[model samples]
Target: MPQPESQNQPIAGRYELLEEIDHGGMGSVWRGYDAVLDRPVAVKLIRQQSVTSPELAEEFVKRFKREARITARIQHPGVPQVYDAVLDESYEQLFLVMELVDGISLRSYVQPTQLLPVSWAAAVTAQVATVLSHAHAVPVIHRDLKPGNILISHDGTVKVLDFGIAAILRSDVTKLTATGTPLGTHQYMAPEQVRGGRTSPQTDLYALGCILHELLSGRLLFTADSEYMVMYQHVNAAPTPLRQLRPDVPTALEDLVLHLLRKAPEARPADVQEVYERLEPFLPSPGAQVSAPGQAGPAGVPDPTSIFRKPYAPRARAGQQSAAGQAAESATAQPAPPVPDAVRAAIKVAYSRSDALLEDDRFAQAAEVIGEVIEPAALALGSESRQVLELRMNRAAIWLLGGDYRAALPELDALSDAYARTSGPSSERARACRAQAARCRAELGQVTDALAALRDVLDVVRSVDGDVSEEAVELRRDIGMLFLAQGRTTEAHNILEPLHADLCLVLGPDDEMTSEIAEVLAVIRLDLDGPPS
Candidate 1:
């Protein structure tokens, strides 16, 4: 359900930001839904304060666009796919729409009392290296790579997040520096980054080393009282070897960590390939039973090596039908038994509550009220049954009224076809559904498709109830307005001229609807005649 703060308004007319997922000094990330695609997305809203001046704002926009394009080119499964980059008209808000990765951050797994298994740490690190290898090939350096930016997805695949975010944030950091707003995690920052030097793939390797060290030792590689002290330690301090903190760590793995942590960029391993090679020794072989090496490190941790153990394993079979799936499948799957009396009564009550919610302008909650009864009603009455279909139509109306056009569009389309199949295409219900679907398309800026859909419904209405019917008049007005919006003034005039005449004949020129059409036609005529000579 959408929150009140969002009020169903979409970002850039596409993504509807739902809930704040994470926040930092730079900006906040939101769990959002992409209305046009009907899918979930993660939206990162960059802080505007970073762009202090006109020149910096211009530079930031250019850099943000460039970074977004490069980030999209990485093309690795470990990297969350970038869907789009949006800068609002005023350039005050910047957003990056990305795949909503469902996973646990590596930060959550790095508790002081809970050391990760040696093989697990190597598996996670190796995966990160593989991702870095691809990104580095694209010549992208992840300026900030830390445990918090790494995630293990549900299927045991590592996801390196915020691929180009740090670079975008750094664009305006020089201006923000005076405000004492730091740009990166100091503990995981590379020495070069700390010293304000140029960064390359080697810089990311240093951060990866910090992550591996923390994963193995169950603590940050460096600790200090302040960010300055942390940066100072990063530049001057020698990282303690992993084996010293975790005796079970293999010598070669510790050596690789040390290799990654080398202060000089050129002093680090040649590339991520070399780092992965050293890690290969600790990684489990294909189909190998993976377990913590030497000692149990942590309980209930998701095994990162499962990708190797069962590469591309098939989806697990569900033992029982899920209620969500059941509800969806019941639509057009097969007819079930008739609705029980108790459920029928409950559906009636639900309808009343949903109507009240809709009157209050709580569209999401209105839809939710109907949704609560859909599953049970669908299970008993069957999907295409009159009662169930009515419930779906009402729920879809709520979505449409809420300005969730993407959510409503598909459901309306489906319901239209269902009505046509069950009650005949020219039936009032079917025609109404088609008109509603057109309205959704129009709202979503699909003007061409919306016009065609509206025309088709209007033709059907004319055949059923004559051209002067209320529905016919409304559809004609909608089609004319769409043409006018597209600047097809002649076509709009032609459509509305006849429509306005009919409204006056049927409802009288003084009627509200008739007068509104008269007003629209008056404006169209003025535009046609070039503004009263």
Candidate 2:
């Protein structure tokens, strides 16, 4: 979340960066101080070269506001407080003002500390889970939940920072003509995330499991030399067992972590609370004797410093040279065996025209393009290829529009199950598929199921690096209507009111979502036969 380079410039005429603290593919963070608040702070300054589109710039503003509002809603002591969001100078760069934390990231703490004592790891995990439960309750997903994002303060307090904003800076720019969505830090990413599927509380659970695995084994859950390979691992790799590295690691903690590492989101714990409950009874309470609670050492005693690297190196090697050589090899061997030219051409023809068809209201034709045309073309390439599943997603969207929700079922359901094996339960793509499956269930009149689908959307959007996009607004609108249809007046009003306000802000009063939600409210009022409820 800290974007370096904030040190040189005065942000919004208030905070001035002192120096670059860290840098990454997304942006850089800086150490700084708030001139107004009169305290030390961190500021993230997005790179100028990275800003590629006007729409993306606008999205940055919206997401920045979303972070400001959403994160501020959580007063968790284990979570950093958002000081301010400053966007100025043509909106090209944003400086996010946040509480300054002087501590090593959990990733770093675990490297030299390798295989933290189970009790210490569990206590830390519990603290993280506690914060996660609240964040999920608010329905915020921290798309990137690797060790670097977890901070162990000087006082031994554990704070979860850098929520889900990273993806806004690094989406799939190369995949413009591609059917598949981009992904997050691949190693820690859950299986669902790799397939451009949906996420929920379970996605975070998967990440926690990865953290647990690493903490106990001093090893990454997956090993790939490059980002693509890491992502492939998420899409199609089995996790190594915790006990494989350290046989003495407690059976239940190992079970709990593996449970989170399930191949399917459905098989995982429902929320962070479940993760906490699974590990807490054995954990010593905060400030308790480190040995008793199962803490590694007194919070700062052994020190979590040097444990792992930030955003984490996907694979470990005996030396830096070997690691780089492996990375180069992995980069050169992507999508394995290379997508064929003919298959590539066919995929381009079948999948590249989504928005145009949606605008034309040729929903069924679009479905045909994806299912009959693109899907077959992809299958002609290889039915089991990543491109095949990618195109299937396009077809599923069409299925939603044509109101043939059941027809969408085979793709959605199979994809959901497939992603569990591919990405692990926690990946954003896996979560996305789960959310899409939920939508299909709702459309099919499985009220109990639809509620789950909409509920899952609420949780999925909270994930880090997710593409909730317009789907979020659409889900709110759909849920409002569904509740009204079910004669659940109170629920309808609750969903519709915020949906109306959000639509008004983004789409303006003249847009369809705003207009549609307005009409729904009117119907809701009439149904109440009195007040608007």
Candidate 3:
């Protein structure tokens, strides 16, 4: 936890601390001004609590400084440029200053209701892959790759942040992160990371797989009541296939995501370059139109795919004639053909079969059945038609039920849009659709968005029905859980404590939902009380 330090204090005579932008388990990230350079910089104040004794602290400082230097050596646009690493004479605090990214954390984008387009998600992952390629060349393993550490700049560039835990692959350097202790976030940790096995580039790849899955599904790959459970899943469980979650996801893309999540590092993609190559097809091509009608557009945000599509894109010079330009002008694209009624009937039967399969927990079969109809339905009825959208939505639902979020998220988002467009935005159906999407976001680790969406839906539900309605109660419960996930225990307690009381009064003490809330509330109270001394 970061204590609020007074502002306007200049450290090392050059960097002036301004305000804290973010904080985490390791340290606080401050938005600082560099007096010498006359530019804004992000100053990370490492938490002293990470060390125990004086000798260990000294060693930690050395390792931190060395890692910072190694991080600076990674030359890539996707990585924030490292400016300086300063150690005070007292050695009480360590500061790392780097280029301040004007962007939102990737965590914000992992929303079930407003999922990124396939092209957008692919583009972001591809850029990350490119960055990893460069970093691996210098033999630096990020060691920690999570949504929190990835920033999407206003310019649409993906910036990888926080190399604090990064390990330089040098034989002479002492191992700072000792054996028998894992160093990454439990949710994104690779199997090897959980087992305290040697971390290589493959370790980062595993983390990337977790991120990509979350990005695609709007949910984390795995979750549990405790960190130990999550770690156990990482080491022992198999990831649900993306196609089983979202029928719209390309088979190749789903295969790639699964490949990246392989328990054995060797079974994963050979390198980040290979990952990038695999992602190339999903990325927007040069001069290709990226947005479509009825789809969520970039809405003024920079497009990440623009880098690969139009590197150094510039305005066409006045009266400058180009052969490629002429060819592009002469070419005209064809529209998709309409779907026949016979195909529609086939789609309906497939959907029914899928529903039955889903009930039996045959997620793969359910998804495949629906998937077989999606292409034909889209082609015949138009991709955005109500029937086609419903088919897609059903497929997404199957994915969600099967715990294949990456596959489900995009479908839910598209369905949300379709429902809003067809039925009014505030319609009960639309709200329900949005709520389901938010649930997916929560599962994926987009706590802030999930809380906001749930609250919004809860307000509507309460307005239409009442505060104690099942929908409202469920929304409140979800909001509280999201708060807990964000480590805002007080807020979680505030919400869950009341909600649980209400549930006990209305639904009875032994009701499943009430009991669930009670269990969570008890845990929150424990957290609020602090550990037994």
Highest lDDT model number: 1
Put the candidates in lDDT order, highest first. 1, 3, 2
What total of clashing residue pairs does each candidate reach? 0, 52, 9
Q: Lowest summed lDDT over 10 consecutive residues: which window, candidate 1?
A: 316-325
TM-score winner among the candidates?
1
Put down candidate 1 lDDT per residue, 454-481, tens digits, no spaces: 9999988988899987798889999999
Q: Residue 190 of candidate 1: its Cα lDDT?
A: 89
Please provide, for model 3 over 396-475, each residue's C-alpha lDDT reduced to its tens digit, 9 standing for 90 to 100.
77778878765566567667777788887777767877888888877777778878888988888888888888888888
Worst 10 residues of 3 by lDDT: 316-325
Any runs in candidate 1 off by more than 4 Å, and if so which?
1-8, 166-183, 291-301, 319-533
Query: Which sections of candidate 3 miss by over 4 Å?
Result: 2-8, 172-174, 293-301, 314-533
Deviation from native of the Cα of residue 155 in model 2, angstroms: 1.8
Candidate 2 wrong stretches, greater than 4 Å: 1-9, 112-114, 164-183, 285-533
RMSD of 2: 27.9
Compared with the true structure, all predictions reach lDDT values of: 0.81, 0.68, 0.79
